[model samples]
Target: MTNTNFLISGKLIDIVSREIIKAELEIKEGQIVSIRKKESVPDRYILPGLVDAHMHIESSLLIPSRFANLAVQQGTLGVVTDPHEIANVLGEIGVDFMINDAKKVPIEIRFGVPSCVPATKHETSGFVLDSNIVESLLKREEVVCLAEVMDFVGVVEEDLEVLRKIRACKNLGKKVDGHAPGLKGQNLKKYVASGISADHECSNIEEALEKISLGMMIQIREGSAAKDFEALYPLFDSHPEKIMLCTDDLHPDDLIENGHINYLIKRGLKKGLDLFSLLRAATYNPIQHYGLDLGMLQLGDPADFIVIDHPESFVVEQAYRKGKCIYKDRKVLFETNNDIILNNFSRKSILLSDLQVKPQNGSLHAIVVKDGDLLTDSLLCEPKIDNGNVVSDVENDLLKIVVMSRYDNGKPVMGFAKGFGFKKGAIAESIAHDSHNIIAVGTSDEDLLHAINTLIDMKGGIVAVNNGDREAVRLEVAGLMSNKTGEDLISDYTRLRKFASGLGSSFESPFMTLAFMSLLVIPKLKLSDKGLFDVEQFKVINLFKDL
Candidate 1:
């Protein structure tokens, strides 16, 4: 027989037993063969590899290759990903990119079939996946579940199409992920009954507890815009079994500066959480929940674990995925060819005349983005009057927001949004959240047009076009990320932030802030590449027709 067994000797922290003991774990191919007591140097603490229960690789602003390179060094061996960002950009092809890229890496990457492509019918997504596409994707070997079903309202109402997709997943015995924000009472109960197994969108203790009580795994998400760690760390103390950790959407700068799973692990420790429970939540829970073929240091388990210099300190010395050392010394030794051609949605320059705002009448609803949360707060604002038309008011820091259909649909919806605080020019991005559409917000009509066109010229990425006098900062990768390293991306992002701040935005980072402006799935008010959307009503609110 071939030499299929290799011994990994270390002081093991068996997640199942919650103890540290000397053991030699054996591995044959991708599975764990056996474990036995062994004499060890005892210089390291070996624990089950960390598992990210939920995350978005696109948010890392790196393709799968670079992402794996950075993440493995931090002791992460697996990630449950929802590539909805790319799905919104390229549909089936985009989802394939993520899957193929993961296949090239040593880490175990489980996918969640993207449940919401455009996130909603209102947004302009590059591609669309119906029940047919979703059902097909769920059959993949690595697909673990249906991605976050954003259309909670649609599900409860038993929209035949939405329900059809749910039933389709059920037919395949796959899990359903939830994205219900601020849902409670009977609505919450009904939503739970729809078979969503987890929710990573909780922003407060109350919501976190409520979802956990209903038997849903609450992934404490600490991502770029949505930082819920501080608010829900208490869950680790009381309900450690039901909680897991995830970075739902972290930008490149944040990833390089703070790290991924390691960042959350350290934060939990500082919050006075038990080290054992933290490790369990970070590793065991996710493994058990997904039924992954991961090792947990037992009589027969793959020799997959990490050597940490200090367990309490949470410093990773070396990381192994499937018994192979993939990362050591804070550097990635392995590389995967995971590059794809970025598709450009901008056909031509968007002019001010094209973005000219009209007046709206009746009870006007606007999207309100709560700082530090992906959820939005809807508010009613008085319309600006201009020749019997509602217009943008730079004086009030209210700027015009537009969602252009780049998927070849000619329908364009324009809305007005306050709080962007644009002082002079405009900001445009192709990395709109959930649905990667062309979203632009601006004060100066000319700059708005120029900004949109500039993004079009680059094909994809975020761009800040200042007044007639300012320079444009371009992110030319996928319109969502910079192909440059984290350091270079941060420098460029810094410049864009400063430029946007100079224009009057009050936020610390403006370009990333604008990217989420059209995320109708979050809450309150948001513009898809379609028109003014009321998430509560889940309908398009006309900008001028109603007025």
Candidate 2:
């Protein structure tokens, strides 16, 4: 410990300590060597750099390299990322890209073995990960544990491949994550019995409480699709030790503005949560849970701590990882070379003719999405037939929703959904959740066709099609992320937002709302790369016929 490079002494409070103390810290290489003298320090607050307990790097809409730059700026020295979105689109190759990019960053990025690639057997994906793939991925040094075992329905039933994957990760002595939304009673118990150790998809206080009671670490998610802050924040008062913070899926613009874990900290403080508790949930609890090597400002730990100008404002004055400053003020210093690897995965142009639906004399089943929730509201809407063709009525607020397979799966599944708030024209995106499918919502058949085709021409990304004209935004990186910075993505997103607003859509961010179309786990109904999904039943259903 004689080769210490820097001696950082400050006012330090261990997350477990009830009282603050003065400490002198010594760092050699990247690890903390010693801490002595608890009677001298005065100003700086030495705490562990934040850790995002769970997240998806793809959701940030940036490659791992750029996302790291932004995250480190927010004092995040570590994160556990599930690359399921890109893995669903590019298969093993997608996972390799993530691992490769993550290595370029100074922060510690723990890769979670994606438990569900297609997510369910009912969907079409670019590549399918069997038990063999899961086994191989776990052997990697960077792999932490099994990613959110999204197919909870399959796991409970002891589905062969699902069980095999779980056993493989467990055999390697790694943890297994859970994603059972609204699952309670015996089903919840069965789900937990499979060696799955944690959950981040909790939607309500009841669900969070139940999971925590069952010995699962609850990672309170505040992301693009699932927002559980208000309902779950109260847990900090009672179960702060067992609780953690995560941004399961944050958009690029939101990441830039609100930050990753820092935003969650600010919001929690505003709601009257104790500062130490929030810091513990964000830093100590997560690192301890994931067994990360992120060093806190303690004796014999790595010297990774942030210099906060103001703890109340949560202003991150400077961020240090391994005792080296990576981010200062609002700028980041990283040797980033985010190379784009675009695999053209768009399908042939789909038209109004492809989305045709035959007459059903009974109640027409419709997939509905709530304004601000990821879980949908399933309802019945009478089929509106105009000149022997099912049409989209903007006045009735029932615009046509379609999900098309883009994985060259031969048999493309199409389904109708309502309540997307589309007025005139249509919008299509290749950014559908889980499985990257083409989802379109439009006022007319022509506009819907135009929207889908526009997304196809761009290779991948979101597009807004109005009448015969179209605007294509390209995300040619794995069809999930762009190798662009937040400012550029925000500029592009602003255009999409303004275009959708001009078309009479009421939602604050229509593209972000539309992106969740292919998420099969969220309840009520959703269209996937495969067929119409009834999430409650956890099975594929006939779009035209009621079963």
Name the best candidate (by TM-score).
Answer: 2
Error of 1 at 492 (Å): 4.6
Model 2 has how many clashing residue pairs? 0
What tens-digit string does per-residue lDDT give for candidate 2 at 149-221? 9888888888998999999999998889998888898899999989988998887888889888889999999
lDDT of 1 by residue, 295-409 (tens): 7766556667788876656778887666677767876657654345666464566555676655545645666655566666666777667765556777876677767765564
Q: Local distance difference test, per candidate?
A: 0.75, 0.80
Query: Considering every candidate listed, which one attains the maximal lDDT?
Result: 2
lDDT of 2: 0.80
Least well predicted 10-residue stretch by lDDT in candidate 1: 469-478
